[model samples]
Target: MAPVISSLNPNHGPPTGGTAVTINGSGFTGVTSVKFGIVAVASFTLVSDSQITTTAPAGTGSVALTVTSPLGTSNGVTYTYSVGPVITGLSPASGSTSGGNTVTISGSGFTGASSVHFGTASASFTVVSDTQITATAPGGTGSVPVTVTTSVATSSNVTYTYVNSTAPVITGLNPNQGPTSGGNTVTISGTGLSGTSSVLFGSHSATITAITSTQITVTAPGGAAQPVSVTVTTSAGTSNALPYFYITAPTIAGLIPTTGPGGGGNAVTIFGSSLALTSAVHFGSAAATNITVNSDSQITATAPPNVGTVLVTATTPGGTSTVGLGDAYYIYVAAPVINSLIPATGSVSGGDDVLISGSNFTYIDAVFFGTAPASFAAVSDTQVVATSPAGAVGPVIVTVHSSGGTSNGATFQYQL
Candidate 1:
C-alpha cells in the first residue's frame, strides 16, 4: 500500500457539522474511506488524485483526519474540533426586584449551541450568530456559574450574580405625633432598594407597600412610641437605622388669667405640645401684647387687656386646638384707640415735641414712627406728648402700645 498525505486545508467547524475541509495528497483517487477521527464523513468528492473535500465531524477539541484507499492508507492529517462555544462575558449581573433580564454572552465556538444555563437553572437562549448569544436569566442568588452546551460538550464556568440593590431610609416623620397604635404612612428615602421583606420602627414591624430603590412608603406599627429608630430588610441584608417620633397633639393645658394684670402687661402662660413654630395668641379680635413659645407644651403670652370674653388658641404642626372661652383673661382696662394727634409733622433730627391726643392715653406705653421708637409722656386720659426719634424722613406710623391692646397706628410726618 503506497500512499502520500498532505493536510486538511480548513479543519475546524460547528458541532452541527457543516464545514468544507480539503485533504490534499497523492493516492486520494482510489480512497475507500475518509474518517474524521472515529466519526465517519457524511460525503466527499475527489477533485483530483491529490484533492478530496469532506465535511468536519461533530465533537469538542482536536482530532486527526485520514483517508483509506485500495492503494494504501493515507497519512493522518490534523483536524481540530475546536473548543466548543464558550461564555466570555455577561452584561448586568444583577436584575430588578421584579427579576427578568435578557443578558448577552460573548465568546467563540458557538456555532451549534444546544442549551444555556444560569447556575443549575436552564435559561432560554437564542444563538444570534457565532460569537453572540442572548438569554433570559432565571431567578438565582449570589453568583452562579453560567455555562453553554453544544451537540458536542458543555463549556465551563462563567460568573453571573444576583443582587438586591435598594436604599430605603426614613428621614423625618409626623405626628412626631401619632398614636402609639401606629397606623401612619411615613415616607422613607435613600437608594438601591427592592424586594423589601420588612420595615421596623424600633422593634415594631411597619407595613410597607411601595418599595423602590430610592424610597419606601410604609405605615408605622404600634408601640410604646415616642421617637424610635426605623429599619428595612431585604434578602441581601438589613438597612441602617433612622429615627421617627410619635407625639401628642398640642393641648391648651391651662392659661394664667387670674395672675395676669387687668391692665394687660401680665404674661399669661399656656401649656401644650406639637405647637406650631409660630403660634399666635389672640384676645377677642385683638392679638396678645407678646407671644412666646416656651416649649412643645408651653407658651407664655401677654394678655391683651380689655374687659370682655376671650378665647385662647393652641396651634401645632398637626392642627389648632382651643382650650377655654375667656380662659386667657377678662381684664378691666379700656383698649387704647387712636382718636387724633396734634402737630403730627416733625423733623426726624430731634428737637420736635408733638402732642398726641387720643382716648385712653393713661395706658400708653411707647410710640413708634414706623420702626423708630419715640419718647412720650402721658398727659391725661386723652393726651400724650412725644418727641419723634431721629430716623429716615418718611411717612411714619405713630403706634401707642400700652397696658391695653396696642392702638391703631396714627399717621405722622418727619421733616428732613
Candidate 2:
C-alpha cells in the first residue's frame, strides 16, 4: 500500500532548517524514506502505522515534502523554508510603566511585518524598511518580551523593561544629629536614590559627597541650634522628610561650694546655664557621680577623687563645655591631721591648753577632745592651739576638722 500525506505541524522554518516535521496518514508504516523536494531528509522514524516524523532537510523557499513506503510513494504536501524577522535591538529600551513612547526597532527581515507586539498585546507599527520598524510602546509593567510577526513566522524576542517611577523612600539616617557647625558627613539610607538632583538640610542645600541607588552621603549645611528637616530630590520626585537636630555647645557658669576634700565623694552643687540636658559632669578629667539636674541653671553631683584645683565642666546633647568660661573653678584641699599634741597630758578639770601639730591645719573649723568640742585657733599652716573642754578623767583623743574633712586622732591622757 502506498503512504498517504496528511499535514505538517509547522508549515515553515529557516532555510538552513533542522525543523522536526511530522506527517500524518494511514499506511505510513515501513516508510522507506522522506524527502523535501529533491533533497532527502537525513533520517525518519515511523511512530505507528499512521505517522512518520523526520527532520526537514536544508532547502530554500516552498518545497514538496513526501514520504515513501515499501508499497509506494505518498502524495506531496507543501512545506515552506523561510527566514523570519529578527530584532537585534530597540532604541530607548526602557520606558515608564505608563507607556506611549516612540521606540525605534532595529534589525532585519521586516519588509512585511504583520504586527508588532509587547508580550501578548498587539501594537500598531510602521514597517520603516526591511531592516527597521518604528513602533510606539504600549502600557505595561516590569519586563516583557517584544517581537515582530510576519505571515510566515513570529521572530525571536528581545526584552523591553518598564521602570517604576515612584518617588524615593527614606528608611533611616546615620548620625541623624550633629553640632550646629555643619560639616559632618551624613549618610542617608533608602531605596530609589538613583539620579538624585539635590539634597537639603532644612532650607540649606548640602554638598553631595557620594550617591547610589540605595544610599547617599552629603555634607550637612550649618544651621541654627534646632531641629530641621532633611530631604533628597530625584527625577521621579522628592523623598519623605526626616529629622536632623543641630545642637549648641554647652557652657558652665559657676559652682556652689567650689572647695572640697582631695579624697573626694562630697556632694557639690553646680550652677550654670543650659544645665537641664546635662549627661555627664567632669572635674578636670575625672568623671563625677550621682548627677542630678535640678533646673536649667542648677545641677548637683558627687565630686570624683582628685587633688589640686581643676575646672568643672558639663556635657549635654549640645556639646562639652569649654574651659575659661564662667566661674567653673574647683579647689581640692587635704583634710587636717593631728600628728601630735605638744602637751599630751591635760587636767581632767578640763581647762588644758594644748598645741596641735600636724599638716593641713589651714581652714580648720573645729577641734575635738574625745567626744567634747574644744576652742581652737590656727597659728600656721601646720599648727593649731586648742583649749580642751571638760572630759572624762582618762585617755581622750584629740583631732581637728577642716572644710576638706576630718583628720586622724592623736591620743591624749587626762589625769585626775
Candidate 3:
C-alpha cells in the first residue's frame, strides 16, 4: 500500500533549519528517507509504523516535506522556513551604565531567537512569545543599538541608550554629633541618593537602616574624637564630603554623697566636664531617673535601685564615661544595725572605749550616745569601735550612723 501523508508538527521554522518535524502518516514503516523539497534530511528516527521524526535541513521559503518507504512514496506535507527576528520597539530605551535592566523587545518572527545584543555586547534573553522577547541589558555606556538574531538573520530596528548616573549629594545630617563609641542613628538628607551603594563616615562604613531618593538613615560607626568626612557613593560616582564630628565622652569628676541606700532613690549631684548634654546616668547597668542637668559641669540625678558598689557614669552625645576615670564611685550600703555593745555601762564623765557589733558596719559616719555624738571607727562590714561621749546619768540610746542610714538604738547605762 502507498504511504498516506497526514500532517507535520511545527509546519514552519527558521530558514537556517535544525527544526524538529514530526511526520504523521500511514505506511511509514521501513521508511528509507525523509526530505524537505528535493533536499535530504541527514538525521531522522523511525518513531513508529505511522510516525517519523526528522531534523529539517537549511532551506528557505515553503517546501514539500515527504517520507519514502518500500511500500511507496508518501504524499507531501507543507513546511515553511521563516526569516530572522524583527525588533519593533524597546520597553525602556534608556538605563544606567551599570545595566542590569530587563528590556522587552517586541516584533515578529522571534520563534527561534538565537541572541540579543546591545551594540557589540551580547545580552541574556528569553523568548516570551512569537513577537516578544525579554532581555537583560549588559553593562554599557552611551547610546547603543539593540538587535535580535535568529539562526537565519539579525534584526536591528531598535536602539538602547546607556545613561550616566549622577553622584549622590549630602546636604545635612540630623544629630550630627555622637559618641566615639558609636551605635547612634543619624539621618542624612541629600539629593540624588536614590541608588546609594555605600555611606562612609571618615573611613568607616555606616550601616544603612533606611534609604530614599533624598534621605538615608544609618547607624554611626565608632571613630576617634574628631571631625570626619561623610560621603555617599552610587554607580554614578562618590558625592561631595560633609563634616561629621565625634565628640569625646563626658568625664565624671565626682558625685556628692557618693554612698546611698541599697534600695536606691537618693539624689546625687554629679560634677564633670562636657555634662551639658547628658542623656543618661547609670548606676552599674541600671539607668538613673529624674536627671537634671544643672550646667556644663554639673548634673543631679536620682539613683536607680541597685546593690553593692557600682561605678557611676554619665552618658551624653559625646559618649559614656569609663570607670576609674575620676571620682565616679557609688557605694550602695544597707543601714548599720547595732546588735550589742561591749561595755553596757559608762560614767557620765565621758571617754569610754566600747565595741559595737552588728551588720553593715562599714562606712559608719558617727556613733551617738544619748544626745551627744561619739567617735567611731569602722572595724569591718559587721563591727565598729567607738569612744562614748559624756551624757547624763541615765539609760542612753546608742546608735550608729552611716551613709546608708542610722541604725536602731541599743540601751546603755550612764552612772553618775
Which segments of candidate 1 are over 4 A away from where they belong?
A: 1-161, 164-185, 195-197, 205-212, 218-225, 258-268, 272-291, 295-297, 302-311, 316-416
lDDT of model 3, residue 113: 83
- Write one digit per residue (lDDT tens) for candidate 1, span 1-416: 65577766765665556677888888777887888888888788989988888877676667778888887776777777666667778765555433456778988767788889987889888999889898888777777888998754588768887875444544444334455556767777765456676788888888887877767888777776377887776644567887776554455656654433355667777765556453566666667757777676677877765564555665443345555333433444566777776887877686588788778777567787788788888889988888878866777887887656678888887777
Q: Which pairs, if any, clash in model 2?
A: none
Q: What is the lDDT of residue 22 in candidate 3?
A: 87
Give lDDT tens digits, candidate 3, residues 1-416.
87778998878777778888888888888888888999999979988888888888999889998888887788888999887778889877777798876788989988788888899999999999999999988999888899888755688568788888766788999888998989999999999887676899999999999999999999999999899999997655688998999988889989998898887888999988888889999999999999999999999999988898899998888978876556898999899898999899998888889999999887788889876898878889888888988888889899988888889999999998
Per lDDT, the best of the predicted structures is 3
Native-vs-model 1 lDDT? 0.70
What ordering of candidates by TM-score runs from best to worst?
A: 3, 2, 1
* lDDT per model vs. reference: 0.70, 0.86, 0.87
Q: Model 1 misses residue 263 by how many Å?
A: 15
The TM-scores of all predictions, comma-separated, are: 0.34, 0.55, 0.55
lDDT score of residue 228 within candidate 3? 96
Identify the runs in model 2 with alpha carbons over 4 angstroms from their true place.
1-164, 171-177, 183-189, 194-198, 206-219, 349-351
Clashes of 3: 0
